[model samples]
Target chain A: MTAISGWGRYPINDTEMIHPRTVDAARRATVQANPGIARGNGRAYGDAAVGVRQTIEMAHLNRMRAFDPRTGQLTVEAGLLLTDLIATFLPRGFFPYVVPGTSFITVGGAIAADVHGKNHHCQGGFGQYVENILLVLPTGETIGASREEHPDLFRATIGGMGLTGTILEATIRLRPIETGWIRQRTFVADDLDTTIGALECGDSATYSVAWIDCLARGARLGRSLIFLGEHAALHHLGERHVANRFPLRKPSMSMPVDAPSFVLNRWTAAAFNELYFRAGARKAASSTLVPTHPYFFPLDALGNWNRMYGRRGFVEHQSVLPIKNAQTTLAEMLDRIAKRGESAFLAVLKKLGAGSGSLSFPMPGYTLALDFPIERGLFSVLDELDELVVAAGGRLYLAKDARQSRATFEAGYSDLSFFSEVRRTVDPAGKLKSRLAERLLI
Target chain B: MAAAEKAVLILGGTSDIGRATALAFAQSQWTVRLAGRSLADLQREADDISVRTGRQVTAHPFDVLDTDSFTVFVNALPDLPDVVISVVGLLGEQPRAETDLDHAKEILRTNYEGPALILRVFAEQFLGRGYGSIVGVSSVAGDRGRGSNYFYGSAKAGFSAFLSGLRNRLAINSSIQVMTVKPGFVRTKMAEHRKLPPLITATPAEVGEAILGGLNRRRDVIYVRSIWFFVMLIIRLMPERIFKRLKL
Candidate 1:
């Protein structure tokens, strides 16, 4: 047994980990004495991907089963990462329809979380693009689940947090692109009202997101810089950019050691936010053409960026409020943080479209995600925020939640009973359970 | 006929290192044939390679312990391979092998007898055709038999000596070439549990690249990581009196 943790590096657990290379081996792993959870890249920021006793690392099972260039449909093993897919097909004019902030997550993990990207307002979550899935049950029975066959299982497995079973393979539809360049526009919003106005105006863009200055208070409350982007067409690219249609570069530098907690205080964060806002305002026409990597995943350029939060690690709290109440709920939450002198190092706000799955964490609204380093009484502050969010008819994303009460979770998601009923029927013995599942009574 | 597509046959193709070598050759436009006890397991790998590299890859059944079927297995191939690589090895439990005779015998048969006999069959065909190359995957453990894994080490020692003698016999009589490969601490399914130092350990893909490079250069003996050549020299030069008193 060895110690393993998710991306946040909090709540580490000692578990028996196995890497199975084939479907038969994966089936055998499901029948082990201890209940197992299939881990893909461990990018989920909490205990949802970590098991109590056993964790099955699915890196070795990555294989591309089939790819039809004409239809742009690809069948791949569950362990294949989005980064690998981009490297292989981006040059051939293909890209995933919906991609999360980071491209390091696995296909199975993406489906389990039903991850949404900047284009969520137009494309929807990752589950919407899934054609079908192959699952290996705890009883060692392999079944193919799709819209037509086992529709209930299909809905439960997507955004199911891997509680139903281990996902073996999946067939997903890929979007065709002319190039890997993104034409982007930046707008600086001085306060919450302006930020919300900018986001609403850019709802028709292919992709749109906002970087919020959570430390800003008074007249500058909820100040943010909104970025809007669309895939660059062949005719839109410059001569120099055409030569490198698909470009990928490894992280130029990395955090070799953990930083001191005191180094990331309110003073440093405020200065950084000021400089970032000013930099965005300086650009003429507030527009530029950038490679997909930097435009989509800025944090990925600095490897081990999480270590900057120090040894105690951090908790990423991402909550979504219905559009009707989003502006008020978000302003109240931001005011609470500023009043306490507690600042989030990174805060993101995005608009989400309609959702379909039972446990999917998206709606026709706005979602705010923030990262705060663990410290004394941090849980109490987060608990208070949860009450406000629940009252506003908002829900926390399971993929990023580390500490949330069962009552809060139940209040946020009204379909909890239906999800529980489906889970019990599929996994009656509770042979597949995660720490997050047990904590939330899912 | 498109130059009859040069091919290589891997004996233990289910192994990580063996699969990597098959992929390397297939990427270079070589037809690959993978042989192992279970054709079903091998077929999955074959299909994966075919999709990735768009090359001709086929899997066949061959039991290393079944000596009687060796000739039949080779004759059943669609075309005689231009190169044959022997990667079959068993690192059985050292403590169990030391106490149980059956475990010791299994280590010897898997590492030495099985691979040596299968290569002998291919060597005969190459000698008659006056062309082809044979590569044997030996280990640095064979250079000096340590008490921890001497059962597996001794079998590799025998395989290394066999390849050396075969090289000398074919040097003047025929163009058939024999090469011995000694690797130190390659990261694969076989060495997953071992606590190996990261700097000295090489990945299976690295070992595969070295093997292909060595075959292209036709070197008589090569080490996967060149540092292992000097490390083994120091071990071989130690006096018996000093070595016997200390544990390796």
Candidate 2:
């Protein structure tokens, strides 16, 4: 089975897990299906890749159907991975402008989620970078999308969570890189305010992110470390320069099994955070040699870091808020979590840049992603967070959502109805659906 | 929904918890702006917000790293918002990170550097505006780290601490509201799990509600679900050596 979701751990009927090696095969598989999903590399980490009765493995259909060098635009079967694009284009000085956190994902999957990258603050997401897309609607009809063609469907398809239809191919723009390495720097913020202050105090760059220590208590509750980067100047390439044009040695490992849940309690995590915090002494460094794939998506290399959550597998609660709610909102949230005693041991924060896409996830405010083992009463806490987000003038990412309610879905993404209306006009039958769509009532 | 037309802005517009929180505001009475990097993705989100809340909504482009422009974005807005939700993160790999320093660097940078800078500007703006709520999504991970994603966890640990400091600073200035949201397990795309057990897991909506409730009560550092209070209390008591050997 491909790695689409932690949910796929559930036993699937033998009829599921359909591997389709070609476009025709995928079509045939769908034509004679036990109800399935069009799966890519399964990097989505959600149930969207899995089907109720069957799952169509679309990796075999990967192929670069076409390319346009001058525009740095290319068309490929949806199954293609960012890795594939990087390999095919590095020689041509082009790359997928907006990538997710990893290179293991597929072109179709990226489109489905309208994935963003560190440069999202600059380039937006895959949706904006996409010049066009080829999709197989729920009605089994193949179609294309662009600014001018099926505009609503195009918008809906991006970050649509693979609910609109099966993405067949996408024409996307590429980015230019030098030696495939980033010029990076790091800064330590004594507190959340300083960290927030530093990010805005710096110059514009291609990428930026932050890590915070939440357990310090009192004065250091939201203290953090910030890092910023820009594409290395092309002229800076030295004799030591090298290009890691391919995935070296298939960097892969799997979680042999789930560990115990209580393994990551506060005391253990607090020590780890303290020990880990003082280790990063390097502020600014320039090296000709950096693995582009690993640098862009190191988590993918771990294969199963989720096992760190133990047998129950964990969930990520990520969200964004406007500048107005920056301090107090965060304070209230941390206090609430502390008061309740949930150990979301890992929380990372980042500032967003300005860019727009139909189905994108980054924004101008701060964003936080935290991992937590599933437990009781968690939902109510999330519900409180939902209220705060509402009052604060923010929205959540649908592609990353799983347990959100229909009311919340409607509240956060009120504009989806227009997309939904258009979707209804396209496939009136509601053939394209997933657990997310069901739960959110989208 | 009303002539006052309160609006909520989610800076980390792509996070599940952020989205769910936004939905909660929509349900009440507020125009929702699904602010983020991709306007298209946020457009659908805006649409959803309006439908749920029966309020007008729109998607706007924003850049937290560019605080100079943040005010411009706000001034450019048709109306200023009453609340803000910030949920962001980056979990870098710990193993490869030890060998590939860049991986480790990205993990720390993504979690701390970016968010810290922008929130400063947000606070100043809030002071000038004299009325607003800021919900920063921090994690219990920052409370500490395990062998896994330690760099990422430490960054969050730092953020969690920072939020507390910010709250204390804002307390004297009653005009501003700060809420730190720390949730344990939330079922979302980032985690990708089904049947998250009852003891620790939560949905984005649940976290959303808790955050709002905390905001209304003017509380600080809200746990998405209350059970995490007990769970962490126990986890914090475990001995270090024993905790290290723990396979969890």
Q: What is the C-alpha lDDT of each candidate?
A: 0.87, 0.68
- What are the runs in model 1 whose C-alpha is more than 4 Å off? A284-286, B1-4, B128-130, B173-175
lDDT of 2 by residue, B102-162 (tens): 8887777667765666566667787887888888887777765777767888888877777
Where model 2 places Cα greater than 4 Å from the true spot, the runs are: A1-15, A28-36, A242-250, A281-289, A353-359, B1-248
> What is the Å distance of residue B244 in model 2 from its true position?
58
Query: Candidate 2: which docking quality band?
Result: incorrect
Instruction: List the per-model TM-score of the A chain.
Output: 0.98, 0.88
Residue lDDT tens for model 2, A99-136: 77778778888887777776665556777888898877
Task: Score candidate 1 by TM-score against the native.
Answer: 0.94
Best-performing candidate as measured by DockQ: 1
**What is every candidate's C-alpha DockQ against the true complex, given to 2 decimals?**
0.47, 0.01
Looking at candidate 2 chain B, the ten consecutive residues that score lowest on lDDT are: B45-54
Residues B1-248 of candidate 1: C-alpha lDDT, one tens digit per residue: 23237889999998988889988888778899999989877987787777667688999998998989999999999878899999889999999998899999999999999999999999999988879999999999899888889999999999999999999989996889899998789998888878998877889888788888998899999988888999999999999888887787
Tens-digit lDDT track of model 1 for A330-410:
999999998887768888999999776778888889999988888898889999889988999999999998899998899
